[model samples]
Target: MPEHSRQALSDYAVAHTTKPDSIFDDIARDAQTTPSAGMMSGRTVGYFLNTLVAITGAQRVLEIGTFVGYSALMMATALPEDGELITLDVSEEFTSIARKHWARHPDGHKIKLILGPATETLDTLEPQFDVVFIDADKDNYPEYYEKSLNLLSPKGIIVVDNVFQGGRVLQQDVPDDQRSASTRAVQRLNEIVQNDERVNNVMITERDGLLLIRRRDAHLA
Candidate 1:
């Protein structure tokens, strides 16, 4: 697509998509105060996650990253009254800010933030998550994907963010060794999901990239 055409469609999408509630707008603005504010999840990804929670009737959610809680709050808002979401992150600096925002939302009571490497923290939990969203360290995506499977419920779904690595996965001109770790890791993940017969997956072209997966026997697509 040409640059002007792309921008026009993007503008149309933005104009048609529902805006976040005023409270969420506040959280987004506060997220900008961080040095890595650009790392925050965009509106499209956030709304998609919220829809997933509602569609799955998910009572238990596990979030692998909690950058200022934009995504966490999105999912939390869609959860039922008795629903629970346990989000893992290693940065107290960011999660502290997340906590503040979560407190401002009514459904925020459903979220729990655990501070530690998710690789270690993931082991302590039971395999009961109805929905799992992974958006943490790029290099550790492979490890996270495996662990997420172990914790997933029979009818659960997995949503992965940044699967495209800003479209680096397709640069065949660059040798594997020379490419960045994130790019290489994302390539490997896409391959892993493609080859796995135990599940079915689709790569959504929204945002950076969103990979939605489910057990072959899962009720939802």
Candidate 2:
């Protein structure tokens, strides 16, 4: 598809989707102006995450990355009154910005922001998350997947973001070693989820890419 056509379709999709409130709008504006704006999950993905939380009725959510807390805010709003969400991030600066917006929202108290290496933090968490969202460093995608699976409830769902890696995952030969490593990690994650017999998965092409995996069960069938 032509770039223009694709963008038009995306615009249409966003237009028809559930709109976010003013708080999310403000956070999005800040994220765009920030130096690490690209790290933030955009509005479309935010809405999708919100919808997942609603549809699954997820009481507990675990987010591997919380860049400025855009996705966290969205998911938190969709949760029930007593629902809880724990978001992990390594940067205090980014989480600080997130805390500002979260403090103003009514559901903000439901979110717990943890600052530090996600891998170490994941080790401390118990297996009770109903939904897990992984959007952290690309190089650790496989490790995140493993840890997320271990932390999930029996009927839990895991959402993996940036599976496309800005279309780099499709490239057979990436000359840059650093970029190659990141791309290879994403590729490996896709392969691992695809072949894992413990779960059933589907990859969606919505902005970048989102891989939704849930345990294979008779109830699901």
Candidate 3:
């Protein structure tokens, strides 16, 4: 499929699905004017995250990236009134924008922002998250996955973003560079999940790629 065609289909899908409210629209508009606009999860993926939280009745959610808090806001809305979402990011600048938007929503209070290196922050979290969404640095995906799995509840799910690494994962030869290193890390993480007997996993191609993993025992039960 051509890039334009794929994007058209994506746009059509978002148009037909349940639309996000004005608060979300406002955040998206603000994100578009920023240098890191592409980092936003957009409508399609945001809805998917919301649906996952709803289906799981996830009371405690852990988000690894929290870029502009778009995904966190969507998930936070899906949570029960007493639910909580802990989001970790390294940038104060990006999260400051997120905090502004979060303050507009009633459920915004459910979102907890922690600014620091995620690798260090991951260790400080309690092992109680019902859903874990990892969308942080690609090079640290393996470490994030390992820590996230330990933090998850027995019946929890882990959603990994950017698995396709901007289509580099499918290429036969990649130049040796920092980007290639990130691509290799994503590929290695996919392989690790594929071979792990403890979990059942599936990869879906959307904006980027999403790898959804669930504990094998929970999946079978």
Q: What is the C-alpha lDDT profile of model 1 across 1-221, one tens digit per residue?
A: 67578668766776777798887788788888889987888677888999999999999999999989999999999999999999999999999888998887889999999999999999999878999999999999989999999899989999999998877888768987899998988888989999998889999977678999999977653
State in Å the error of residue 93, model 3: 0.4
Residue 16 of model 1: what lDDT? Answer: 74
Off by over 4 Å in 3: 173-179, 219-221
Instruction: Tell me how candidate 3 scores on lDDT.
Output: 0.92
Against the true structure, candidate 2 has what lDDT?
0.91
**lDDT of all the models against the reference?**
0.90, 0.91, 0.92
Give the lDDT of residue 19 in candidate 3: 86
Q: Candidate 3 at residue 112, lDDT?
A: 98
> Residue-wise lDDT of candidate 3 within 68-154, one digit each (tens)?
889999999999999999999998888888999999899999999999999999999888899999998999999999999999898
**Candidate structures ordered by lDDT, highest first:** 3, 2, 1
Stretch of 10 with least lDDT, candidate 3: 171-180
